[model samples]
Target chain A: MKENIFPAIRLTVICLLFFSGIYTLIVWGVAQFSTNAGKGEIIKQDNKIYYANVGQKFTNDNYFYSRPSAVAYNAAGAGGSNKGPSNPDYLKDVQARIDTFLVHNPGINKSDIPSDLVTASGSGLDPHISVQAANVQVKRIAKIRGIAEGNLQQLIISNTEKPLLGFLGTERINLLKLNIALDNLK
Target chain B: MNTEITGIILMYAAVVAMAIPLGKYIGKVFSNEKTWLDKIFNPADKVFFKLSGINPLKEMNWKQHLVALLTINLIWFLLCMFVLMNMSWLPLNPDSNASMSADLAFNTSISFISNTNLQHYSGETGMSYLGQLVVMLFQFISAGCGIAIAAVVFFAMKETTAGKLGNFYFLFVRSCTRILFPIALVVSILLLFNGVPMTFDGKDPITNLQGDTVQISRGPVAAFVAIKQIGTNGGGFFGPNSAHPLENPSYFTNIIETISLFLIPIAMVFALGYVLKRRKLAWTIFSVMTIGFLLLLIPTVINEMNGNPAIAKMGIAQPMGSMEGKEVRFGSAASAYWAINTTVTSNGSVNAMHDSLTPLSGMNALLGMMVNCFYGGVGVGFLNFYIFIILAVFISGLMVGRTPEFLGKKIEAREMKIAMIIALLHPLLILAGTAIASYLYAHSPVAYAGWLNNPGYHGFSEMLYEFTSSSANNGSGFEGLGDNTPFWNIACGIVMLLARFLPIIGPVSIAGILANKKYIPESAGTLKTDTATFGLMVFAVIAIVAALSFFPALVLGPIAEYFSIY
Candidate 1:
């Protein structure tokens, strides 16, 4: 009985770990099966959608406008521009993005611009924006609607997140939700 | 950076003060089993005793409890060994990958279970969601196991009149249910509040400006980071590690991360002294570990603060000394803190890129890993430190011509042999491993080119540091070594196992032996372990051991690196 007790305890611990390992394998298989789908599925933001190519037009009017992405798919495959932060090529890219922003955002000036809107996030496909980024476009959107800028500001205020539960991500507007809200207003 | 003054000061004050009180409270609570907490934990206590076939109702001499606990931990080790071998096929893999190769798998299992978590492959790239769950889940349990063991030992030794080695089951259950769990809950809620994503979904792809769809990584990251910090298991869910913006997010989170790295370690040290009536004993041990911590920390801080001179000459600001491998919000001080904390505790999680650290700064980070103190990680550090303390007790015993005794337990020849083996194994790996790596280069082609081209003092140092850190379970690397290959991987694997189990087994056996002996009352002639003089001796012993084992290697590695730049 004494000998059995020690062996039994050892066997239980070993068996528990052995099963946990097997369970982990099963869990890995399941997570992998679900993993290959894509980020939107992983994050559960199915409402968020975009074209795979830059030239593809986004004609949805009810969705909020996202910053134009210059990232391209090519025969060469996927990657960032790889331009150093201070490179002229990078600067020129930024200039071109700003021009596009200005054309899309009529009557907006340099003073009202949020740098993040013009600049790409590190991963280059950010779906959210700094509250400041949303606000810069707020004035233009309000003017287009012939509404009070105050109401537009109110719209942004209501949309701003509290950050991760209370302390994680920076305060920002969800680009998808804002566009949907715009349609609701009409 | 300037605007967060009130917050930073408050954080600093809170960490320093709250750390002391929290530590003292844990110490007092675990001193004996009289609190309300005992009632709640008693059930688990009873269960553990039954599982071990021990009578919870029957009092055990310390030896019996030690054997039961040791046997349980050994079973856990084997379980990890088995689980890691097959974790790749498991679930939650946003990225489907297979098991780490045998040696690396073995090392990684030991790493996390030991509260080391010194990972070779990036989490996002290498592990499935299930692997993280199974492996990291054990991190929490093993971490709790270590803390409980430490508390049990402290409670055992603290009983001056009659040694009441508190129930191992009670200690294990309470430490997990009470301490680790509650802290993890608070931190997770706070992190979730801060906008760190907490969803459990598969990968989500978004079309990009470049006209290609990009797959974004996602999972139960809040759960991962919470335990990573609380358990002092620092592996991140993503490849870029904690540096990934999604994983860490912002400045407030950054500070919280820093505090998480140091909290339990600091508390454990405080508990050590409080266990003995001489509160100073803990401080003495703290002083040795702190000195080792600061020796590396200050240099890394200064070098990083100085900025790369080349970057400065090229008209770049170098971003205030944290330009390389660091986020802008954290700046230099916090990065320095992470580098130091992980190395001292052997946690191996990094907030910045070690490769980009100024040469001297990087060396300090690497060296700190070699000197991983009793603060190394959850259950492991105290075991390592106590071994040295035993050594110090014996060595001093020799000086005075008395038999060595610690905490009313006499240190014998067998115990000394175990301590010597534990101390020597680390150095042996450093010297022997580097010699072979350097020697094999003449016949092999892999490591011959990159950093080893010159093959002088500098190349040797990098190899030496690699083995030293790996073998010691101190996970930081020189980042210069070509360690991603089979030769280095397999070599590091052997070193990792030897450095890991040899250190653990010796002390546990010693603990078992000590537990069996009848307690000897303190005498006037017995050398007090809790004194400043002894603290100094402890520091010297630790320093001398690190020096004796790896100093020659350090001379070749960092010393040569310094000469290379000059």
Candidate 2:
């Protein structure tokens, strides 16, 4: 037992020094060339700074609604609400989201609210919303902002990010970027 | 788009290209023959053996090997539990993260030691630097332990009756030094170059462009991330796992990370062929596993790329498929491929969320883990598959009216009993655990509140996926289950330990016992295991066994969800 135990421990300690120390230093040095020097990509708009990679919350009526967040879009502690369908709390949460969406967009029926709009994204910081999620809220946004529905539709068209190579993820709108564009519109 | 497609093709080509030579190198190292690494590692091996008074030439019986494996694992487990539970006082805790609770510590210690890195907690906020080190240490050791046991079984199959299996200590060390560590170092360095953080600092407070400040947690991410993927240890440095930009920055890193997950396990298969000088048999086995892998990959990619049918009803353009739980950086094709790759190898790291996948895609993930033998984690994958091979050989031998034998050893009733037990144990643990969790959830609704994120069939899948992942020792979660509570922590911990150790014990023990039996040389009348028929038979055994046990649970979960979604 000692034969294997002692040598195993020795090798483990040796590995620890290299894997934890030297290997880490090398990687830290390499991170130097990445977009933010490994500090995450930052976007500066109107004197405010935001991480372009992370999802931002846009709950106002004139802007596109961001995907529901489990952690309320806290990038520092991002995760999904791990509620399965059978759980009453999860069902209630979805129902509550549906109710809230109906209240905001009175023109849309209860069934029209997309799951993406009600259920939270896995990464609570998901920055994009499904094109349906974006479109469903267009009426509410147009009514509040006094913008033409066609103009809002055009804005949606301009803000849409196509799937890579035309067939990867869904066509989606970055709520932060879209709302920024909306705010800029005269 | 052409670049991405070309890149995917190139990655596959590169993995096969690297695996062949790497496999040959591994064969040489383990066979104790002369090799290039002998110059540096030879001295290191000798010095350690000399100090520890271990005879590198001394062989161990299967029982002895098992004991050594268990004892060393127990030691690591204790060390890991202690460190994790005392995280607050530990050094390098720039975040001053509080120590984990007892149940979580138990769950985590068992999870890593078992090589199933099913993390119930997020990385950045949950653990400190020292805690991550402990986890990283276990990742190497756990991965090494798996390969070493496989090496033991490999040697056992080669030796004559009562012949000695190679020393466990030697193989374990070599597995780390010659195999896992070197590759991990290179990959870790590459990831560093690609922008994964390796700093020892705590959370960095960032003032965003919106003037809203958020504290971005940081740690020794690069080193952890490297081994985390390569060792098939998928515990992430951040909560969203590789989905987080820092963990997997660009297409280049994604391809690298994806390749690293399968490289060693695939190489080990080829290594078996090289070592045993049975290239045909090796290829036959490799083909079966790869076919099974690609079979699951096809639908997952299609379903995810097809996007959600429900969304299409709303007249939304879904040019990209279902991007709900996936990142744009890693599109549907890559994410779908990654889902199967990670599950198949027990490398549970995710560039996308498995929980957010369409129902059919989610089933694909569950099925991969349930099958659990497609180029599994470094060493144990081959070990797990060995059980099926034995059964197939025995069954075929019976069909042909001949005595059952494997690699020259007679597959007697004793051997059959062990293999049967090992084979049955996988589904038993998964189904039983899921049944328990589901029954509890069903009977105790209020108590199980917030336990599942999605309701109905998808909810059942979260429970089923959890157990399947645990029992397979592939630690990827459905991610929607509130799994951090005591019930999940303790329950899954038990499942992980049983699932991991029993498979190792059963297969290695069978090899050990068979090693002591009378050797029968292959004759013209002997059943040939290297043929395509034998491969098909083995695949059938895997399918029958997995399907029989998991079909009902799967139907209730992913299949039902699939029908509803469609």
Candidate achieving the largest lDDT: 2
Q: Choose the strongest candidate by DockQ.
A: 2
- Model 2 chain A: weakest 10-residue lDDT segment is A82-91
Q: What tens digits encode model 1's per-residue C-alpha lDDT throughout B1-566?
A: 23223333444455556667667756766655355556754674555455556443444445555555555555566666666677766555555667777766766676665565666665655676667766666666767767766765565454342545666655555566566765766675555555455555655556633234555556666556776776767776664456554566566776777677677877887766666665777777777776777677667766766665433333322334434344444455566667777777766666665544555765676667666674777656777788888888988889889888887788898988988888777667878888888788756656466533224554555676667678767665544465656677667767766676566667766776676567888889878887878888887888788777666666665565555543
TM-scores of all models?
A: 0.72, 0.87
Model 2 agreement with the true structure over B195-306: per-residue lDDT tens digits: 5666666776766434456676666677788888888889888888887756775566888898898899899998899878888988999999988988998888778778
What range of 10 consecutive residues in model 2 chain B has the weakest lDDT sum? B1-10
Alpha carbon lDDT of each predicted model: 0.59, 0.80
lDDT per residue for candidate 1 within A25-142, as digits (tens), equals 3333433333232121222223545422111112222234554333321111111222222233444656665667677777767545544444433222334555666766765677
Candidate 1: regions farther than 4 A off? A1-186, B1-13, B28-70, B81-91, B99-103, B155-170, B209-212, B394-412, B446-462, B478-486, B509-526
lDDT of 2: 0.80
- Which window of 10 residues has the lowest lDDT sum in candidate 1 chain B? B310-319
Shift in Å, residue A169, candidate 2: 9.2
